[model samples]
Target: MSSKTYAGIPQEYAKLETSKIVLIPVPYDGTSTWQKGADKGPEAFLNASENMETYDIETATEVYQQGVFLADAVTENSSPEAMVEAVHKTTKHFIKKNKFVTLFGGEHSISIGSIRAFNECFDNLTVLHIDAHADLRKSYQGSACNHACAVYEASQTTNLIQVGIRSMDVKETTVLDPEKTYFAHELATNEFWIDSAIDQMTDNVFITFDLDAFDPSILPSTGTPEPGGLFWYETLDFLKKVFTEKNVVGFDIVELCPNKIEKSSDFLAAKLYYKMLSYKFMGENVEDDYDNTYESKAQKNNVTKFNDDEY
Candidate 1:
């Protein structure tokens, strides 16, 4: 990572020993088929975060005090599969430290690794995949690690709940469960979609948020900009409810393709990240211990198994 501290916080809160949170930046954009600037996302996000106000008004908390250790950027780009493996190992390493591990990504494919690590550590994992596309292809372009197949493993292993879906391939429908998917059109009219989506989640949840899930009018810098997507307040409302009701083990935000002329998207990504952290650690003391509440290895024996052959 280019920045010394996450959001330029003092060294006290940026140290790994005292920090309650770990932020992993995976700046590999090898698999994005559209816009190619997602590799620059982590640096742009860090730069924008440096200028953001640490205080959050809604929660009335400075979540940065919880300490954010910005780990080295995952630069393993030999192949899409290699990058995913590197991300999986790094995320698992932090989760084992009992830290609230979060990731900012180069593309949606990075979620495959982070989600895998979380699913292994948490029992009865529910993957909340918020994206414009279904992204359920078992494999794309001869590689399962392609961005297009980001959540195929989760669909088979975890209780996957999809939201804000407006674009998808017909083949993805075979893997998608309509009962658990909140399509953009349905969400537009459904007054209780938030509650409904939350109700279907298991106790342990891992969120994978794609930037394109937001409408192009609000966030147009994603690799794939989709129309008729989510807005800010409503997205925050849904996220707050999830953090409040579920054991949100970890999360990752992906698909940010920054533009030099338009910097709002970068700031939005930074604020969105801080907002999620605020919700997670709201009302908690920095001195207090943060237990990610992951299942012990023995306890995870009964959890949904991840099969490499399937992927």
Candidate 2:
């Protein structure tokens, strides 16, 4: 029952706290095709979180004000089915305690387990998926419960609205509903489509973000880096709209393969986690404040102490 300061809280129980949010780290990566080290993702993301500021400049709120309790890391399960059961049980416990569970994943496969937990409590829930790959394959290699089939398993429990999808197999394309799926290219070309995409989702939404959804330039630590994908503000704006218009029950951030070479990806992931909290609680008011304060600070800090003439 290790604890740390999160959002100004000096000392709080990891999961038992009445905090608004809980971080559940799932360090299981059994079905990665390209990258093998995704099992280490939870610790990497947690380490990066230590350096993360409580203030979210983009959301204009110290999201930690909402109270984020960092739970103990979940032990890795042997099989996907076991992992799913573990995640489902843990999430149910959190939901019962009235805390919003934000699962930190070892790979995409962890989502199936988390979603199962949510399904036990919420009826008529919909999943809003953000990923570069469709992940609609019934099974990959020999496992139907592979990380590549996370969304496929989730679809069994709830309706799905997939976004930022740039890569998919022909088989997945055939099975997925065209009306429900929003491709990354379509989102890029038509800014107004975001609203239309959100409209397709049910009010009770569970967001699952695979870090690879962003282009490799911004999120290069993913196992499979897609070329063209959502930018920072683009993704944030879409999420803002979702939280404003829909009831986001919970979310999971997955597929972060930390690299010693680039630290930005880890920080970006941590900040985004906090930003989601701000949007869910503060809504549009927070966004406005964030922009005003962040922009003003940038302008104020632009000047150097040393004169340019010295060069």
lDDT of 2 by residue, 1-311 (tens): 76554433445423344456788888888788897777777777777777877766766776665557878777757787788778877876776555667898889988887887666556677899999999999988887778889889677668888998999899997668788888888886786788888878876788999999998998899888899988998889999999989888889999999898888888888777878888887753422333223234324323112222322
lDDT of 1 at 111: 92
Compared with the true structure, what per-residue lDDT tens digits does model 1 show for residues 1-311? 34499999998889887788999999979988889999899999999999999999999999999989999999999999999999999998887766789999999999999998988877889999999999999999999999999999999999999999999999989999999999999997999999999999998889999999999999999999998999999999999999999878889999999999999999999999999999998969777855444454324333344443433
Give the C-alpha lDDT of model 2. Answer: 0.78
Q: What is the lDDT of residue 101 in candidate 1?
A: 93
Where model 1 places Cα greater than 4 Å from the true spot, the runs are 1-3, 289-311
What's the lDDT for residue 46 in model 1? 95
Off by over 4 Å in 2: 5-9, 12-15, 283-311
Give each model's whole-structure lDDT. 0.90, 0.78
**Candidate 1 lDDT for residue 63:** 95
What are the clash counts of all predictions, listed in order? 0, 1
Candidate number of the best lDDT: 1
Clashing residue pairs for model 1: none
